[model samples]
Target: MAGVAMQLFISHRVASTDVAMAFMIQSMAFVCFNKVSTAQYFVWYLSWVPLVLPQLVKHSGRQENKGLITAAIAWPFGLAHWLAWAYLLEFQGYPVHLFVWGAGIVFFAINVWCITCLLVRVSSS
Candidate 1:
């Protein structure tokens, strides 16, 4: 389901960065809307993250925080790690659901920041 939608989004992109961002955004939305998320869901976006990393690293920006852009893209994985660990602990009868929810909020915010940066980049170009 998510995989098919992700493919459709990625296939329509005309730019390398666009493709990478498409994958990232699609994966984020998929996980957000789904009932359960596994580490494999994170892998879907992490695989494409590297494709966009070099572009961000090489991007020449005067007012942009290249580090923020990078963090925006990378932070989701860290949150995913927490989510996975939290889920593991929860399965062991610990009350750590708040960690999952908090990670989700943070991930969404970081993604929004990345999307804003991308929009600004596109508009300026």
Candidate 2:
């Protein structure tokens, strides 16, 4: 978990309330405190990283490379992570389950739908 987390994101600054940092902390706890296995946690973290960053960066000001916003579009996975994790904690042992499944399905589908919409807009431009 720690090894994979080290690569999750790079924030030399104080990192603040970002999802990566949260997962990183949770990863540490799962591995260090609860003795959770690393492989599965790594996969879980990766699946959720995309959904987490934006809210973290909401206070992060602007990206150093504004053009990279498209790439950073993955950050919203953090928001999904927050919501899904909450639902999981309330319902699925906090590890992620069917309750959060809707969140993932919606997030991924909306992701595709939004991307297609954006592409259409760009092309029409």
Candidate 3:
């Protein structure tokens, strides 16, 4: 799976035990949130965008600033997930849309931060 590959790649890049496990826990959370709509499916994928950077880096075989490039490609999903969460919250409420959106925002923010920090560190090194 892309998610597992992502964890392994990042773990190798930084050699951080905490970062490695964080990806796995997040992957499980994304998987466990079963039975969602099409939009929700994309958002779920977006939530995993941060982890995917390392996988993309590995796949690309680029030697220079690979993580930064992959994070750039993945950035739109993070922004889109935030916007989609907002739209869903306003248009509907039957499915506790507000709660879901809030959760999505939190996930998006965390992933965005993680990816940003990782890319910055990787780039500066």
Candidate 4:
């Protein structure tokens, strides 16, 4: 799988923590673009979050980087929204295909924004 290849590439090629963070961002991008992505797929990249959290926190302490912090905070809420819609459609048999699609789009946008903020912070650090 692409994720496995990416992880292996990062492990073998990345010598710096910042570069590893960048690869993690790329992994998140891969999940966003994957047509058949499932909730469990998120674990692939989220597993790196704690490793980079100290860096993120260091960058977020600046007053002007509040937007970055906000995006970080908002991503999970976006995921929850997407999951709620997915659950309704899958389990409740709700006629909400449009809602699910819309939620998916919004979640994707939030994810992209969060990734962008992280990339900026990671690169600038």
Candidate 5:
């Protein structure tokens, strides 16, 4: 798939952890935008998160760099919001397709913002 191709290409071009993390974030975004996404799909990228946690925490420790900290927290919060909407639509049989779609779009935006923050930190460091 395209994600695999992207990973392979990125791996060949750069051997930095920042690039690896970027690839994982991009893969996660791809799954988020897919027509059908399941909880398990998240594992593919989530597994890589811990590897970068130290880097993220290090950057976020600076009080002036509020964006990194906010992004770190917001990413998961955005996921939870999307999951709540999805759960309502899937389990409660609510006519909330609009809400689900809206949540998904918002989540995608959050992902973009988070990735931007990550890349900025990576470039600066």
Candidate 6:
């Protein structure tokens, strides 16, 4: 049901902004439905991140200035995902643990911030 809604949201094609926003919304939604989620679940959205990266840069219009700041946000988001997955692999045989939970929350927040930046750009434009 949630996945379908996300797909429907993505189906709209008014602009590149719409695609980027839809991707972000769907990514955040992935975290919403699951009570217990692994880092693997985020793989779907991580793929979309690169696709939206340029959108952020282009919209911001400050690659020389905000470029590093944008990258600063992005690198940690990616690292957090990697760490979450690493935790997942180290205990593949075991059930979901507290470590992933903590990482999940942290990463989710970072993703939300990333999405928020895109969203703000969209609204401002």
Off by over 4 Å in 5: 1-23, 32-35, 58-65
Q: Which residue runs of candidate 3 sit more than 4 Å off their true CA positions?
A: 1-64, 94-125
Q: After superposition, how far is residue 121 of candidate 4 from its true place, in Å?
A: 0.8
Writing each residue's lDDT as its tens digit, candidate 5 over 2-110 gives: 6567556545533465766666666665675577866688788878777877766674546436786787688788889999999999999999999988988888888
What does the lDDT read for residue 65 in candidate 4?
A: 77
lDDT of 5: 0.72
TM-score of each: 0.55, 0.31, 0.33, 0.79, 0.71, 0.51
- What ranking of all candidate models by lDDT puts the best one first? 4, 5, 1, 6, 3, 2
1-125: candidate 1 lDDT, tens digit per residue: 86576556544642454656666656655664566756677677667767766655566576765645575657758676667757767777677677677776676666556655654553343
Candidate 1's TM-score reads 0.55
Residue pairs with clashing backbones, model 3: none
Candidate 4 residue-wise lDDT, 5-120, digit = tens: 75565445443557657667777878876888689989988899888777677745474378787887888899999999999999999999999999999999998787677656
| Residue pairs whose backbone atoms clash in candidate 1 | none
Candidate 4 lDDT score relative to the true structure:
0.77
Q: What's the C-alpha lDDT at position 101 in model 6?
A: 63
The per-residue C-alpha lDDT of model 4 at residue 63 equals 47
Number of the top candidate by lDDT?
4
Off by over 4 Å in 6: 1-17, 62-104
Give one digit per residue, the lDDT tens place, for model 2 in 1-125: 65455434322211343435455434433332332322344454456545554543443434332423653465366445646555567766665666455655554454444333322322232
lDDT of 2 at 6: 40
Residue 101 lDDT, candidate 4, scale 0-100: 94
Colliding pairs, model 5: none
Model 4 spans > 4 angstroms off:
1-17, 59-64
lDDT of each: 0.61, 0.44, 0.52, 0.77, 0.72, 0.58
Q: What TM value does model 4 have? A: 0.79
RMSD (Å) per prediction? 4.7, 12.4, 10.3, 4.0, 3.6, 5.3
